[model samples]
Target chain A: MNRSTGFAFIAPLLVLMVVAFNLPIIYMLGLAFWDKGRGFTLEHYEGLLEAPVYLRVLGNTLRISLIATIANVAIGYPLAHWMRGLGRRARLIAIALVVLPFWVSILVRTYAWIVVLGNGGLVNRSLQWLGLTDAPVQFLYNELGVTIGMANVLLPFLVLPLFAAMIRIDDRLLQAAASLGAPPRTIFWKVYFPLTLPALAAGTLLVFILCLGFYVTPAVLGGGRVPMISNLLDTLINQIPRWEQASAISTILLIVALVIFAGYRRLDRKASA
Target chain B: MTSTPWSRRLLAAAGIFGLVFLTVPLLIVIPMSFSPARALTFPPPGFSLRWYQALFGDPRWMEAMSTSTIVAVLSSVAALVLGSLAAYGLRRGSFAGRDWAEGNFMSPLIVPTIIVAIALYLSLAKVGLLGSFVGLVAAHTVLNVPLVMMVMGVAVRDFDLRIEQVAWSLGASWSYTVIKVMLPNLAPSVFAAWIFAFIGSFDEVIVTSFIAGKYETVPKKMFNELILEVNPTITAVATLLIAVTVLALAAVTLVLGRAGKLGQTLVER
Candidate 1:
């Protein structure tokens, strides 16, 4: 097809996307400068920086995301290594199992954790049953709860790429490494580990970026106390209707996540090359 | 050789632990729904079907379910149409900016879903389309198209174009050739894409939370009920969800079995 005709054919969807998807993001950016709707101003941004609550929430989001990312990568690496050696049938079953929770709603999954970790929950109940504790321990509505909830939600994401990368590695190369007088530790450290780094890095970036934007997990599990940027935004919108401040915080979040993701993409391309 | 046994054992233990970790929440929650005890606890004093009965007897759950089902079905069908056309166009027609076009369509999959939800809610609310079924369907279709494209792209990647060319040479029209020669091969991919799109819309909470404004889908209903009051009915809904997931995955496994054998056969050449 000619250029004009091609553009014509695709124009409808393109216009729909621009109007339906892109405009609101642009509007959000526009709203960050609102000064009581009379004139454009940067008061929201100034408030965001100056407000201790906003700063704490931003720090909390970053800290939680960083911790969850590390936890996911730490768990995902070994799991992926083990998955690589499994037979085809077993591997498929493992993958399906791992991805099962992802198919379920995050709201349900976070609630499930509440039942598992709450006062008189499975863990505390078990501990009491075993005579390990005199009282039921409080585990829910805290940083620990947030981390568990976010990690469980994001674990599949980290595993999928790592599993895919591991599956792509030629098994014979491992045998070759073994034959070349490399110890198992050396072979793992020098050969297998380096090969999987790209996937590990990709999965880490994916999990971290996703965790940064987590809302429901923190909201439900944190009991509206331990605040992240999402919970803060939720409050700003719902409880107070501070649209300007909400818009400002959201724009900051969007920019930070996009910049990190873009950086990861560049690193991924370079690593792959 | 010495390390082999230890490593294997550790791996087996890890695998089992991971499996149990992934599944036990759903498994425990499902059985816990049937507990005669008022509070949600690990072990039940006795068993009753009160929660399931409540779920079935409630009109709200039924309404939410029907709404979700309708939205899911319509959106998946819409995605299949638009995504299939776009996939076919890109696969068959080479152009100067093919990569750019592909990137544009696939960008939705990469962007954070909250951003998409916010963007969509703002635009729809402005046009008074918010909470309308058409708006939901259209939004979900756009979100689902990238998944369809990915799966269909895989299906069409290694297909021999010359088969269609040969049929056309024998006087078959383009549509006939496609329906006869190409579609049968693409059926599994299309079905898989449909499944993904359906599940994407069904499990979707972030977007639905923002846009469902006044109207409640099943997930939204569950979200509200859970926050307001923790009920056995929520557990019942979760159990139902797990059942649906298992059935869906069973069907997927069967499809994968066929696809796997077909792939191995093709790879032998």
Candidate 2:
């Protein structure tokens, strides 16, 4: 095929993307930086700085994202490690379990937390049944609830990559380490851990990026009490009609996400390489 | 190196806990969907289809269901056709800026969806297309393009260009070669890509919620209802969503597994 045929094949999609995706983003940047009469201004960004609400939402988003990402690492690393050690059939089942929720709607998964963590829900019920507490614990409509939901929903993001990396480690290397008289703990810490570090870092970055932009979980689980950046953006665009400020905040988020994604790409290449 | 027995057991316990943690909520919701009572309780006093009845009986929900289906079908088909053609071109053509074009196509997936939502909301409102069905379909098509591209890109890259060259050498037109040769070999991938795009569009909430003014897709409605109250009717919706996802994923896995592309498609991302 000639080169132009290739370009022809891509032309339609390019047109659609430019019109639907690219132009809109550019327009948003224009809205953020270009005022109607002022031509170019940082007024929207300055407005963001002037409001304590924006700063509070930013801090809340960062803190919640951090906690969620940490929870993902805590649960996901061990899960992936365990899957790496499983037998073949068990491994497939484990993979299916992990992959299933990844494909499920984020709304469904976030909603499920309500059923599981509500005051009259299973966890509290079980806690009460076990006599661990006299009263039901409040797991809904709080930061803790939002964090747990986020962690659960994003766990597969961390585990799948980490597990793939763990499976790629040669068993012979471990055997070789064992033959050299290294203890199991030492072998895992010194050899295996370092080997999976690149993938772990890449996956963690990926999950963190996802958590930063998380909208549905925090909205459903946080119940408006805990405000994340996405929720604040929602209020700006949908409720308050603050389009310029929303665009400005979105620009900052887009730049931050892109920068972190670049980092993820570098680590991902190293992990796969 | 083998761990000590106690440590191995500890790892096993932690791993099981993690799996349970991930899956228990979904497992709980499925049974709760069948509860006889109106409350969100576990292990219902009796098994009843009341929630499902409530879901199917409501006209508003029925309207949402129809809307969701139409949007998902139209957008998924569009994404499949456009994305596949682009993938074939990117793989076969030595075009300038091919890499940049491919990256731009995939950017929708990488960018925070909320940003996309806001951008589309602002731009669409400016153009007086906010809450319009055309805008909704176009938005979903854009969001789902990456899913189709990811699957088709791999399929096209793996398909041997020599086969197409042979077809061309045999006096076949380019369209004929694609329709007869390439389509046959890439059928499984096309099915998988369509399913993925369908699910992606169907389950989408953020973008749909943003620009879909006066429109209620199932997820958008479900989200609104959940925020206001925990209705048992939503349990039924959640179960249906789960069922659709499971079946769709099973179809993808079976087809892609037969094609021996499942492992690469799942893990290479």
DockQ of the candidate models in sequence: 0.40, 0.84
Native-to-model Cα distance after best TM-score fit, residue A11 in candidate 2, in Å: 1.1
Cα lDDT, all candidates: 0.76, 0.94
lDDT of 1 by residue, B1-269 (tens): 11478877977777676666666666678778888877878876789998888999999899999988999999888877777767766776766787777777776777777767666665576689878877788788888888778777666666787887799899998779779988887777777778878877787777887788777788888877766667878888887887777777567656756776333211111
Tens digits of per-residue lDDT, candidate 2, A1-273, equal 899999999999999999999999999999999998989999999999999999999999999999999999999999999999999999999999999999999989999999999887999989999999999899999999999999999999899999999999999999999999999989999999999999999999999988889999999999999999999999998898989999999999999999999999999999999
Candidate with maximal lDDT: 2
Evaluated on CA atoms against the true complex, candidate 1 attains a DockQ of 0.40
lDDT of 1 by residue, A86-156 (tens): 88889767777887776777777877887788676787899999999999877778888888788888888
Best prediction by TM-score: 2
lDDT of 2: 0.94
Against the hidden reference, what TM-scores do the models get? 0.92, 0.99
Runs off by more than 4 Å, candidate 2: none
Off by over 4 Å in 1: A1-12, A33-41, A267-273, B1-4, B261-269
